[model samples]
Target: MKRFCKVRWIALLLLIVAGTAFLSFKNSDNRSFQLAKNIDIFSSIVKELDLLYVDTIDANKTIREGIDAMLYSLDPYTAYYPEDDQSELEQMLKNTYGGIGSIITWNTKLKRSMIGEPYEGMPAAKAGLKAGDILMAIDGQDLEGKNNQEISEMLRGQAGTSFKLTVQRPGVEKPLEFELVRRAIELPIIPYYTKLENNVGYINLSTFSGKPAREFKQAFLDLKKQGITSLVIDLRNNGGGLLDEAVDIANYFLPRGKTLVTTRGKIEQINMSYKTLREPIDLDIPLAVLVNSSTASASEILAGSLQDLDRAVIVGTRTYGKGLVQTTRSLPYGGQMKITTSKYYIPSGRCVQAIDYKHRNADGSVGRIPDSLTTVFHTAAGREVRDGGGVTPDIQVEQEKLPNILFYLVNDNLIFDYATQYCLKHETIADAQHFELTDADYADFKEMVRKADFKYDQQTEKILKSLKEMAEFEGYLKDASGEFEALEKKLQHNLDHDLDYFAKDIRNMISIEILKRYYYQKGSIIQQLKDDPDLKEALKVLGDTEKYHSLLSPKATADPAVAEK
Candidate 1:
């Protein structure tokens, strides 16, 4: 009877396995059929449109648009690059391009393409191009009516190629001509690294692209040489790049053969476990990683893995959770498709993907996973963490919201324009770290605004207008007429008063812009550090050894009362 029972179990197992295999085969066949059917339908529609459309349809554009729409439904990162757009893909991955190394913007008001910012030490800046210089022609080809992208394409070429550029300066009467040479402009991975007060080293990692690990290691070593006792890796605004680079970076602080992240997907063969392959440079160093909402992907991986391993104190706000991993597949005819292949789980076995793109809302919108729904995980030290959101900072420092007046000034390009004019008048200024816009300079900026006839809508005024409209519709306007009139008078936006009220903030913005004109990106960072709230908090945490160590302790995070304190 026992033998019969064992035989029966084996038979049932075999039957179940056969049934599953059959179902899988059927599903695969069905998917193939559906795919073929859709392709046929798409081809037929395109053929019909080509044959019967009233206007001449751009087949390539239409097809590309269709491809884009399909990919858009999946996720933002999953993208298709046509043959012509391969340069853009390369720039994104490699972060290197053969160009004059300047940012251009289409000045709608001026109806010209303006040099927004010329990178320092690049061909454009070396050739005396300044911010607000209007591009009239490139290589003698008229840039009139050309958009920023078109102008950019014209600027970019093979390294060592020469081009003649003509630009109208803001102060100059004649159009200045310059013969410029395009060079391989590689954006800085670690833009700035320095030893701060109390032997705390700061490394501002702008991106993870193109040998960031190697560059970051060098920066760290240099900081060590400068006698840095602790390190702060600023991953703020770093949207992330190569996965391997993130792994390599994490390896610098983790032991060999320790898992950093694991990617799981439908294709089991491609699922991977990324580990620290090298011996750590400093495993015992007090590390603080600065992250904000803009910090994502590989940035999250570095931050999350560090947090999970209890290796570093993650400061600032929550990270921009993007746990999805993308892999590029070569397409037919010199094209490429970057497809979202897998979701990655950090060391704590938590996928920090905040949005559920698969289960989108009825309105075709995606929402972040709420705090209530996030599942509790724990760090290596048994500190309670959570998944389905972002890497919550060990010490949360909320970013200060800029005043509305400042926003309007920036949006209207008033600050930028003032800085451009200031640059024209002044040949030199104090270094980025010490530069300040004087009270007299502020007065000049205000005068410029007045002369420009700047106007901006106040949110309060818009809300009041809406309230008045609602009151009228509800038959309450007659009763509240006096109150409405009073509100209107009280809420009236006074430009001069607003300007003075937000002068400090405005001056700071202006000073930073002016500094950029003189010192470039690194200078801007140096200036920003002088007044950075996050950096201040990070310094505080690093300065206090007891607090830093305690924050990483399991008991501190596990106990709610202690955590709150």
Candidate 2:
């Protein structure tokens, strides 16, 4: 029995030695061998410490943290998500979860989580949550110092559960609380759609969801029934969703059997082409696609496919360049890892991937794609198109930045607070499209601002005081220190004068907020459309059939400089 026990121990030792040898051999290969070697050594050390240490240690936690840190070294996207992170991952990919459906951003000036936007028909919107209302706490927990994700997680739960929100508006000294019920927040794929004119239809597709393709088909058919001959598909800040959905959407506009996109990868099966399978809903309809820098992945696929077929004229900014395809691998403990499995190529035979992370400069910056690396491709009308960074627009539209005064007004919650107070005082307002802040209402708002203490960060006052002290000590401003103090006081008085300069911008913001209170998301969008240059451009493109065709046709030889040269 003693001999058998000794032999068993020897066998176990031999197995351990063999395993270590095999791992070491594997680590001594490839460019990332050093990284693997460090991980191996760290693992070995951790095992040894856990087994032989005088105190107990959490092996799983240590390993998880180490893995997280290691992945963080690669890039922001490359992450280690454990079993606990699976739900969050699902929320991002599928874009559905139980929560109070509203988008919130931290107002740095106000130091509160202000509602930036709300999805139409969402629980938050339905519960009377408007943009700019500060979320002080959730279910009695103060949400200060939490990130967007953290706040989202806290707000989300099993459907039908209730959560209370403590909110503080601008003028309100006391915090108001509301009991909100958590529900399955499945944000719709198509938020709003309408006929732009007699023969033109516009559909705002927010995501490529499970039913987006079907929804789009119905929308197109409905428009066709309503005498639609042209369409504008807005894909700004869409951020993309499912690949199959994109293909389905592409098939709705392109001819049957036309190749939409293809994927190439190390894996043989992933290297397959995606073609339109069904008859097109509208092959002859004049389609205009609106894309911006935030439009990515599946959105790019739809736009690129349409561009390749000369089916649509893409307008607005260059698209967000993301050509890599990710596939989720189910791991142990219900966790999944979404690994980059393949590179997606659009119909023009070009990859719209922006970054070449493999090639980096000495300073760790990504090097530009050289001219030699660039290649040419053609669209259906023989239009030359190059790919690498992103899809360039047929016509570029420059974005306008908000003025500083307007920025402060929104950022500081002055407008938000005024809106809340106005909502409380007034029972109703004019329709979203017709609503305008009257002169009397503006006067009342200004008066309220005068009574309220809106403290902006006073860097100028601090600097001026410091400079005055320095000047007095240096004997240069011993005489003029008084003058500097007087000047500072005069500037303080003049600070109110800038209000007139910022009034129009401030009023616009106020108008948007107030409109949202009355008309909801659709109303705000309608109001913004009055000033939206992109919509106007899209309308013009759709209105002129000849000009639209010209824009879609081959203008010049593809510029290599734009792609890689």
Candidate 3:
């Protein structure tokens, strides 16, 4: 039956190609032939399938699937926004969506869905759904068979609509049911802020959404009331949003009329300069900006401006070199195209564009600027800065890469599943600020691992197994079968060691997941801070005034030493 279906599809495809070729050559100036021919061909195929195909076809859904498949070949960022999804697309760009307001990931091992951080004040939080809750079912339908997109569509709806979910709590056998009314989940530009120490304030800015300048001003005002004298603005993994918001944020921290950035393009009319207004916030406050490779666009703008003016020390890995600016234009349908308009340059006369996208290799892959191609520009204090891709942090901090075993553990949700089990067994844990995983708990987790079906693929296993099979087939194994068997046992033992030997790393994962159930998103972050290398470095820089300023100064290019870690 499937073979027959494929044959029909192939026949239809050939017809479409032949028809397209005829229209292309037969009518050079016939817009009607171009549009009408394709439309007519598509209509005929659909009609034939509806009348002759054995299975019933949903015309609307089939058309949508076809359109989606066509667009999927392009980059993920470019998509077809169907009429039904037009409003959802707008909300995504505007940084708001209507749903339960929790990030969820499927745990295939657990045979359920694990909840991530819930946006504060949203339906999920209001209904008492905590992070680490394994979602078993939605509206009485088992979620085991549904994909992420399918579940997402089910969870989202118009505001004020209600949905019911059954969740298996970490420490409980019975699934808990909750009824939640959906609402618009609005993500603030600043989601988290607090005083790190007696005098230093920490603020995590995730996006440059509209009115972010006002939001930052308000956040600072509130922090000022708490006696914040120094500030740590974290922009790690911030992909950026509105360009105007970036300018406004820079204006808040910079001196008036200072050139923050400028944009240039092929068209002279589109080129413009962005500067800070005369009215400024407290410039005396010591500031430290944290960024990583994921920080681009507006995040880069803020970091670049601060570094250029000597206002703040930039720390962490190089920023994502996205200097291109985009503007949205409505298409004929409800769809819109967000096309690149220009490339933005920071104050040092250097465009923080790392990749030379206009120039491609023979294989059409974009190339990053070579060290020799990078141009140097001066900061406000004559500090030399370079432009090519992303903004290079003044103080470079090395990020630790996760070990392969830990990577699989996290990605496979074994860590999350065990954490859920731990939560189910314990009703109450100590306050997140003081809670620590005990040796006894670790023992129980080890036993849990023995019962799990967790599997990992390693190169040694592949090579050893392949060699053993080859030897046996070629009659060479008769001479050394015993040795081969011994080696196989040792390989399996090593595989076992990767799971048990990395107990401390595994424990950290379980601990964080458990902590989040009671303390929420902020709780996990606070608890993890004791061992966070980046946070420790931020604290050290904020504690020392001379070190902070020197790091921002371009002349201070000495490699920062790694202490212990």
Candidate 4:
């Protein structure tokens, strides 16, 4: 009787699956048969693998691998989130977490976990854990040779709980222990803002999460109180977040009922238009929107809308092209699926989605839409704009690529180590915008780098490697050995000479890292603004009101947007 009941249930499942396939294929018998055949084949394969093949198959891992391969054939944005990742997903939307608020790094040379910098007023800061403190143990558990991720997991916990850790300070011989009670760390969304020269306000909105528009409103009001006539909204590395906040920010410079964006999908419910519902805070204020390659999604929406209406002058590189919108659906257990639901279009009727995921290449790889496929669209002021990609700035400022050594120094924490040493000696320094390391200070830093045993590959080394590989592939490596060896010897980088050769670049980086210990993110921003090209360009344009208005106004005397080469 049990066997008969099991057979009946199996039959019911197959009937339901066949019905689903029939409906999906629009009643096409051949397609429906093909779908059933594939399902059967797949099920048989899985069953055979689970029962007969391998010593012991990990069912969950195997199933997830299959699911990942299927999803890989789709767009990058469409993804499946397991239950373990739900917290991270929630934190992205809410921007709050329970942890000992501190940035950490793994010191490869020392083979120990180290504290990078503690967020001001948080657990780590309150515990007197300074930057460069080596985390030797947490909760009496040895942290020697532990990676940053392991140390971070050890540190993070629920609010109101406590974690014990021992850190080795630079001057102190003995390890200092501290028992820090955890709390919900709410990181500042608006990290830095300042009233610049000529009363031009600057607001660097790093993320769009948890009522950022409200924070922006407060920043705007503060700037207005300071008698600022113009504003620069910097969105250089903002990878974007909540769409509602983006719409709210757009509403600040636009009137009620003005359309901001629209989303369209296969379903009717997904088709919706988002318009500004509130009156503008300041409709007449001269504004400049700054963006770069990392600016995307909600950021693109905000920048694109302003440009479409000719409300603000955009200054920076081309933005990250991302127009597809995602929505989450509850999966079985506690897992959730974040799937691409629709594609959003800005006010100019241009979809800034660059990649073509649906129509894959012959090799099943996705390719970005070619420039030839991009169509021209007219803005509200009759200015020409392009669809099928991201927003292009009115005044483009190309970022310079620093030397590979500079990157290695920063990435490998050589600069960080020197900054920590500098901090121990000096309690304070000059203001962020006006601070520069002296020649003596730079000399000490170079000595520190030498002691740290840092080795970095130069771009010339990469070229040499490629040359050697080509010579070997062409069967001439034996004959070319002498020349290759000579080339390698000639290209050898000296740590001593590199310090002075890239002195200016190294100085700027070391200054920023050192200032962070004193003033946090605000310090970094303040220091950067002193030599920021985008800010300079914005200031120049704002100073000349005629040029600023000409960029926005339909009847222009001269075009401010430099044509793309």
Candidate 5:
């Protein structure tokens, strides 16, 4: 019976394929004939390779490789997803996944996996797991020698599954046992929202997913009740998600029936305009959106739409320009492909697609739209905007780069180690917003980092090395030897001096790391705003009613970049 069923299945597949070829042949169009011919050739080549190849071939893998190669000719966003990766993709966009709901990090020096952070109300947090807890083992397997990926795999499973964890929290006498039942954890699209001074509300929309507009509505309404007349929707580093969600979020500020975006494609059926479907939450609220280079796609749609409609003042750096739309099509055997199907245009009739991927240079390198090619578009209030790239900011705020010395300490886990030590000694710390590293605390931190065996090669040393190589190549090494030796001596970085020189920035970093130990992500969020220059500029703009209204009106003077990060 099994053999008969297999034969029947094969027969059905062959009949369907034959019918498709017959239809293509009957039509006799060049495209259909070419497609049919290529498919036949592909089938023949695969059959021959499987039967006559020198080495053993995995048929499924070979076919997948062919599919990937075929898709590689398209844009980067068009991708093939195998059967196994389907679930992961679904979980990422939908925000529903069965896992331990905690993030872990592997310390190469310590050789232990430690909890970096945990989602609130998740299995890991509910099981009494804290930020600094060390995972000794899972089930019967020891986790000490395992990397983050291996340990993470052990913690994930289908919902309703049980797992045993051995966690060693700092200051605890012994390892604590936890029996946790994994469940579907749904993370919020808007992770952080707070009220700032002068009655400004800050809402961070990390991604357009899982009813983000609804979430933003609630957050806005709640803040309105708290007397907030101004809002800052931070889309910095938001890579974006669903397009409809972007429309919905834009609708929160736009009036009903206002055209939000229009998508055009090869197919007339897909070419359509999306508009605000409901009454706006508050049209008169002073709105500013914070965007960075990573803010893209649907995030761009929301930001660009709002900007084109003159609903929100765009702040921060220019956004990530991605105006193309993608649609995922299911393939056979549970596989899928995400194909770029359309380009989205905002209210100003501008497609902010920066890269011209379809057109390549002589050397096959993709080209970006040149400055001369950028077209100008006008907003609803007649404010000048440009196309062929991202949404330009009305005001730009530059972020400070971490000094190399501070960067080295942070990257080498020295800061993490010191924060762990500080938490061990101190029972508690002040609120995140109020927390500040004192002079004596920095002194202690300097000492701790000194002993942490941190080292960094200076940029000047690299240039010196290059100079020495050039001198040697030119046979002038002996003449410059003495000068090179003196320069090397002069360039030798003194740890104590460097630490003192970059004290404020280093201290802020240490303060944040320390906050993470006590308050987790909640603390980090609050503490980040304490020194946020962008937030300061946003508040300044919103607080100054004259500047705010002028920015929205036609022929208004745009603020030059106050500071480049």
Candidate 6:
């Protein structure tokens, strides 16, 4: 009787397993059928619209729009690229292109494209093109009424191809022309690295594209040769690129076989861990990483992994949380689709994807996961960290908001125009580090602002006006009329007073813009560093050995009192 019972139990278990498998197979088949039915319906709808619409339909554009809407409903990262847009994808991945190598901006007032800034050593700069030069024609083709994208396409072509470009200079009466050859322009991943005071080194990494690990290794070695004892890797405003490149960079500081990141998806095939494969270059060097809201994707991977391992002191504001991984699949007709395949977790086993794209609101809007909803995760040293948001800095430095006048100056292109005019008048100026706007320059700028009739809205005044309207609607305006009028008078915008009150900020903007025209991007960075609050805070943290070590320790992170101190 006992033997019979055992046999019966085994048979029942086998039957249950088979039943589960059958159910799984049936569900999979049902999903396939649903997908097929929806696709057929879509096709029929498109066919009917093409045949029955009153006006002739642009089938290609309409279908592409539909595809875009479908994809956008899923996530912002997933996108469709036709053959013509493949170059843009390639550029995003490789950061290289064959073109004249200059940023062109559309002048709304003039309704023409103009050279914004030319890369220092690229073809446009080499050919002596200046910023603010209005593009007139390209290869003998008139560019009048052509948008920036249309003109840009005309400027880019095969390497070694030559083309004629004509531009009208701001000060010059005649149109200038140049014959330029297109070359492969690869933007540098590590733009600038230098040894700082007290044996500290700084390396500014702009992107993770095109062998960033290799370039970064070389930069570190060079800095070591300069006898640096500490290092700062600035990832500020780096949107990130290839994931493997970020992994390789992490390997430079981590030990082999250490898990850097893990990706999980619907399919088991894509779920895997990325470990450090090579021996580290430096394990004991004091490291500080600078980050901001613009630091995202692979940038967050590098920063998050380091913070998780207690390998670096992250400074500045929180990072841009983007823990999603994407893979491109080739589609028909030379098109491609970049799809989000997986969500990644760092060494601490936390996903820092701020927004929950899966559960969108009724109006098709997405919101970030609130702090209260974030799950707490512990770092390697037992330090508490949280997920569902970007990586918070070990030492949070709040950025100061710029004044409204500065915003107006930038929006009106007054600062840019002033820089252009300044460049024309003064053929040479002080170097980037020492450049400063003189009192006479500020006076001239003020006069120009008055002459141009530059107008800007004061936010306070606008808010007061809104309050008045609301009060009138709610039948409270009469009672508060005197108060509103007094507030308006107090908040009235005085351009001359503002120019003098915010002179320092205006001068800084003018100086930086002018420096870029002379020294390009590197110079601007150097100049900005002279007064950077973040760098100052970083330097202070690095300078104090005990404080730096304590911030990364479990005791400091766990104990509220210690952390506050």
Q: Can you rank all candidates by TM-score, best first? A: 6, 1, 4, 5, 3, 2
> Number of backbone collisions per candidate, in order?
0, 0, 6, 0, 1, 0
lDDT against the true structure, per candidate, is 0.91, 0.79, 0.79, 0.88, 0.84, 0.91
**Candidate 4 colliding pairs:** none
Give the CA lDDT, 0 to 100, for residue 18 in model 3: 99
Alpha-carbon deviation at 241 in model 4, angstroms: 0.4
Q: What tens-digit string does per-residue lDDT give for candidate 4 at 1-565? A: 9999999999999999998987877768778788999999988988999899858899889988888777777877667778865656676778777788898877766888888878888888888888889999888989876788877877877889987899999888899999999888777789999898999999999888777999999999999999999999999898888999999999999989989899999899999999999989999999999999999999999999999989999998999899999888999988887788999999889999988889987988877788899999878988888987789889999787788899899888889888988998998899887788999999999888888788898888898899899999999999989999998888888888888899988999999899989888888888888788888899999899989988886654454565432
Runs of candidate 4 with Cα error greater than 4 angstroms are 1-47, 144-146, 362-364, 464-492, 554-565
Please provide, for model 5 over 410-465, each residue's C-alpha lDDT reduced to its tens digit, 9 standing for 90 to 100.
Answer: 76778777787788888888888788888887888888877766678778889999
Model 4 TM-score? 0.87
What is the per-residue lDDT of model 3 for residues 193-286, given as tens digits with 9 covering 90 to 100? Answer: 7887758888888787656777788888899999988888889888888877887887777778888878887788779888876577787888
Worst 10 residues of 1 by lDDT: 554-563
TM-score of each: 0.96, 0.78, 0.78, 0.87, 0.87, 0.96
- TM-score of model number 3: 0.78
User: In candidate 5, what residue range of length 10 has the lowest lDDT sum?
Assistant: 556-565
Tell me model 3's lDDT, rounded to 2 decimals: 0.79
Judging by TM-score, tell me the better candidate of 2 and 5: 5
Residue pairs with backbone overlap in model 5 = 399-565
lDDT accuracy of residue 416 in candidate 3: 72
lDDT of 2 by residue, 112-180 (tens): 677767777777878777766788898788888887767777888888999889887655688878788
Model 3 residue runs over 4 Å out of place are 1-80, 110-117, 131-144, 166-176, 266-269, 459-496, 554-565
Better of 1 and 2 by lDDT: 1
